[model samples]
Structures are given as structure tokens and as C-alpha cells.
Target: MGKPFTVSRETIVLAPPEAVRGLLDDFHAWRAWSPWEDLDPDMERTYSGPDSGVGARYAWDGNKRAGRGTMELTGVQPHRVDVAVAFEKPFPSRSRVEFVLTPQEGETHVEWFMRGELGLVQQAFALVKPMDELMGPDLERGLANLKAQAETEAGSVA
Candidate 1:
């Protein structure tokens, strides 16, 4: 087996840690800001466990780009969330998702990281094309959306 690989992207949002943390807490709320949601608007989705906490799971089945996957909240901290996403279609692999929030000059710096085990198929695909290059843009878009949403909400509240 090859070493585990990771892809990470982050952005600093102009909001407080608590507000940004709330956005990360609810998987359903992700529709408002996640770039993946835009890829397959008709994807089948299901939620189980708590609305926002450890043990919560969000599963989806969609077209090729969206793929089929399940993401479960596996860990949590005061301003962090750790999720594991298992892809079942288009390819199969398990990836870890992490959200970290740090206070900076009254705003929050949010960092999102994803690391995982690449299956044989995905590794093969990566041989021809790097997944990080293909997926980094989407990650950036997601972070941008998150930043916008958090900042907008903070502005409204203040």
C-alpha cells in the first residue's frame, strides 16, 4: 500500500469563531455554501444522527461529478470538526475532512483539510492526472462560499 495522501485548502473568513463554527456544524446547512451542492442539485441526500455534532452522517448519491458518498462527523472540538467521507461511486476511497478555526484580529481564520487513502482505481487515475490539481479549484470555491456566507451573516448580526 502507498502512503496516505492529503489535499488541503483554507480561507480566512471575516467572522467570529462561533459563527463560523455553526456553519461547519450542520451538514444540511452546507447546501448554502458548499460547491459540491452546485454540481448536482438533484442528488439524493439523507441525514442521520444529531443535527450538528459527532455521529452525524450525511450521505449522497448523485451524477458522475457529484458521485456517491457518505460523510460522517467522526470528531469534534471547541472550534473544529473532523469528518470522514467515503466515496462509493465513480471510484471508492475514504477521505478525512477537517475544519479548524482560529481567532485573528477579531475575525476567524478557517482552515479546511482533507486527507485520505487512495484506492487502486483512484491511484491509477492519478497516474494520468493528479486529483489535487483537479479538485483544488473546487476546494477554493467552497472556502470562498463559506467565507462569504459567514461574513454576510456576521454583518447582518452586527
Candidate 2:
């Protein structure tokens, strides 16, 4: 463990808490809005373990942009979902990802966070480009996409 690094971003979705929570619980749901989904058109995906909750998992392998990684839902709740993220290609590292929801009057506030301890290699890389700057834009884009998806899902039923 070198230093703790966290990338956090939030967006308000025009959907109820339950509706938004559904997106976080189901790994496949991510395909609709995950920013990286476009990085590799031929990215291969495997869904395993449980369907869409605590034991749910998602793994993928693709070109350099997509790399290779596996994400497992370690803890889940209506308001929060915790995921264990591991990258095996390009580099190897583990991190904790979380989705937190707070309901507003008619919408839900969703916050996505990734926390990890930067290894020596990462620390060195950070010297050139900080982790937050490198990851922040993607995080922001992901949240925006998530918001759009949630709103669309909510509208479809209305």
C-alpha cells in the first residue's frame, strides 16, 4: 500500500430510488451507460455467479482501451452497492467501487466512488498525471450517462 486514492462523482437522476438502485445491482445494466463500453467495440463480456445482487459479477477482456477486468458486487443494498474491481491487463490492481443513492423529492442523487491504494507503479505514474485528473473525466462521463439512462428508463414506464 502506498497512498490512498479515491475518485468520486455524483449525478442526479430523474428516477425513484428503487429504479436507480436496479441499475447498480445488475451488472449487465452497466452496458447501457458504462463510459468504457465504447472503448472497445469487440469487448468480450462474461456474467457469472449470482444474477444481480451481492454475488453478481462481471468480467471483460478486450483491446488495450478495454484491457481486462472483473467486477463483483461484494455488498448490496437499496441505497448502496459495493463492488470489488480488479484489473489484470495493462496493469494489475484492486479497488473498491461504490454506488450510493439518496432520494430527493422526485429524483434520486447517485454518487459513484472508487477507492484504492496506489501501488508504487501507480504512484510514479501519478507524478505525470494525477489519478483524479486522469480518472475524473471518465467518472464524470459515466455519471452523466447513468443519469441519462435512468431518466430514459423512468420515462419508458410513464
* Predicted candidate 2 versus true structure: per-residue lDDT over 1-158, tens digit per residue: 57999999998888998888888889999988888899999999999998899999899999998899999999998799899999998799999999999999989989999999889999999999998998989999988888888889899334
Off by over 4 Å in 1: 156-158
lDDT score for residue 139 of model 2 = 92
Which number leads on lDDT? 2
Candidate with best TM-score = 2
2-34: candidate 1 lDDT, tens digit per residue: 557777888888888988888888898899888
With a 3 Å backbone cut-off (N, CA, C), the pairs that clash in candidate 1 are: none
TM-scores, in order shown?
A: 0.93, 0.96
Q: Let me know the TM-score candidate 2 reaches against the reference structure.
A: 0.96
Per-model C-alpha lDDT, please?
Answer: 0.86, 0.90
Q: After superposition, how far is residue 83 of candidate 1 from its true place, in Å?
A: 0.4
